[model samples]
Target: MAAKAALPPHSPGIATGAGWARLRPRGGGAMRGYRYEALDGARALAAQVVLVSHGLGMAFFPVHSPGAAAAEWFGRLAVMVFFSLSGFVIATSLSRLVASDGSRFGVPYAVHRIARIWPPLVLAILVTFAVGWLGQNGLPLLTKTGDAYRLDAVAFLRGITLTFAPGDATFVIDRALWSLRQEVYLYAIAALAALAFAGRGARRVLAGGAVVGLVILTADRFFYLQSLALFAAGAAAAHFGGRERLRALARAPWLGPATLCLLGAPLLFVVRPGFIDAMSDGAGFLAYQAALGIPVALCLLGLAIGDGPAARAAARWSWAAAFSYTLYVIHVPVMTLVFSLRAHLDLAPGLAGTVATLLLALLGAEAVSCAAALVVERPALFRRILFRLLAATGLARPAVQAAPSI
Candidate 1:
């Protein structure tokens, strides 16, 4: 038993005050002020690991080599973790907002989400475009898709807003923005659902209609639905005492070691016949990714609730986690640019050249991402100043803090 994880904390209680209903499992998984440091480490670790993966080989190395294969697998696993963790973070943050200010959905939610994804994204796009146009590749507007971007206006708008910008299913400036596009739509659908679940009447009806419309619009799109299922699984785990359940399942000590293989094996068996082909097809790839998320959710649930050594150990990663998103969105352009300019350097060919480029790219990307994260992601002073300015000007409302930094 995890003490009091009685109800699922996924959603917020509608009523306020002392009489508010429980949102966790039957008195088993009570939250202790939303402190999950392990997730911070996990989130940053995922991004950094993927960055390392790309740094090792930006799809330029031999695909079938053992090192490349292992790198790719780790990349897949990290992405799976990233999605589930993101979902958990977003849901928990929303629940926290509702608990504090009592709005089902409002400015804080919209602002936090928008502010989190957009500023850095726009900056990344601009940075990518500038580096491509001025530093190197001065290609025409509609050049064929490759490393650097020709800056498709439609793609940029699509990446910024989930609007129907034709020719935006993929991002030219930064290929990393594709999954981000999926995440934006996921945020939209989830937000609408929260609105519908809030107080009743015409408002709820409109929210429901919006959700239906969103579903219909995004149904056939790439991994949209499957990713939602994975995200909701994370949300469910957070709200529904997944930690308590994890403890129950981990009653036997052996269960802990088994969990690693539990997560790793599914991809080996299910998506074997070329991961690329599976990824292009809608259901199977994301479905496998969703399946992969199961154990990740469990692992996250355990870490979020447990007081064991491994869970607490992740606290070290909290620092890196703070800027993980910045690292993720910008690393691609930063990396691709360095890689493209490799021929200019007087480095050795073969192993030495690859190693040199990887080191330079990785080092540069990390430095830039860290600096960007400081300014954009967690400028505590900046955020405080903004809040005070808003409050003074009468625009400030709920003090809805973001999800404890990353």
Candidate 2:
């Protein structure tokens, strides 16, 4: 979810004061000494899982089955992985900037975060808009035009800026954007925490107040409140992951394996979403989020430090992770396009056709995600573009590529 890169050179830490304006990500997401290939793999796995789960949901659309609920659960499980992994990776990245005895968001931090996250995200939003507009106007390729396909300008602004009130029922341009919204809140809290911890003063007081304000505001939403715990747990997990005592604790590299589906079906059976209205996916649907975050965080910590079969498999899938962020962000539109054509597909007459449609949807989404990644996500072009723009504005110089650090 954090999608940060243009990666820092293995330097002392992020620059501050005047130097902050010049910070730029140069090398790919690499750090000197060690590489978290496992983390990359986990990202790939989570993104793919979400894509497949959504595909499954579309396959069984207009029908309700244990499998359908199970599919939704799997997607939620993958979401937990994304949020947890995001926390871990973000904290790890924050380590460099914050390690210098507490830090505030210097210009470098803003530049890094904006450059890393906004480009691909904006592209995805635009693409979603285009796709949604066509569908809303009866393009025949977007059947399920929930909030995502609605071409409403106010919603677009709210979605892009993440201005929706905590737990507001308003959906974003893409359903996938919900996590991004949550991620924004997470980033704000983390930033304020760092600011609060910086050299003691009234500044800390202001930050502390902001934190309290954030907490009180988010408390209105189930996910908004519980996510703080998950995020903190993930941050703590990152800090402890490097400890010798925790080194061997991460043996299970895989987070939501196929075996977990057995549990999801049973769990969703007990969890219904009607009180807050099924359309909004209220408290009952979100109840498992924090609970799932704990295990997901642990499993990801294991993956980050393990060498088991699952870890090895994850390492091999590194290429897919390159586009994981792009895939996750843009998937709603790709899925909409694919599923729209599902009813039009002439693969077969019965169950086989349904199955084929599902598979095709998944494949189509992946294929499009890959293409979009090449254009936007790959090589961290977004960062480079921002860097260039900054340099043009005299806010930065060409970055000196360095060995990737977290």
lDDT of 1 by residue, 1-406 (tens): 0010112223332233321233434544444434467777777777888888766657354554555555666766676676677676666665555555553446556655655676677667766666556443442222124434334676556555634243342355366666677777767776776666653677678988999998888878776676676677676666664355545653335545776776566445433445544554646556766676666666777777666776778756866766788888888778777766665454457877778778888999999988987777644444455556666777775354442221
Pick by TM-score: which candidate is best? 1
| lDDT of every model, 2 decimals | 0.61, 0.61
Models 1 onward score TM values of 0.80, 0.78
Model 2 stretches astray by more than 4 angstroms: 1-34, 61-64, 99-105, 140-155, 164-173, 251-288, 344-349, 378-380, 384-406
Model 2 lDDT tens row, 1-406: 4332322322233434332213322332222222467777777887888888777777774434556656666676676666677777776666566544234434345555665566677777677767766665665663333433345677566556766432221243366777777877887787776666553577778888999999998887646766676677676666556555444455543344633553354454524533223313556545555665566666666666567776788878777887788888877777777666555554455788778767776777778778877777644454556557767887754441121333
Q: What TM-score does structure 2 among the candidates reach?
A: 0.78
Question: Residue 222 in model 1: shift from native, Å?
Answer: 1.2
> Could you tally the backbone clashes for each prediction?
21, 7
lDDT of 2 at 295: 65
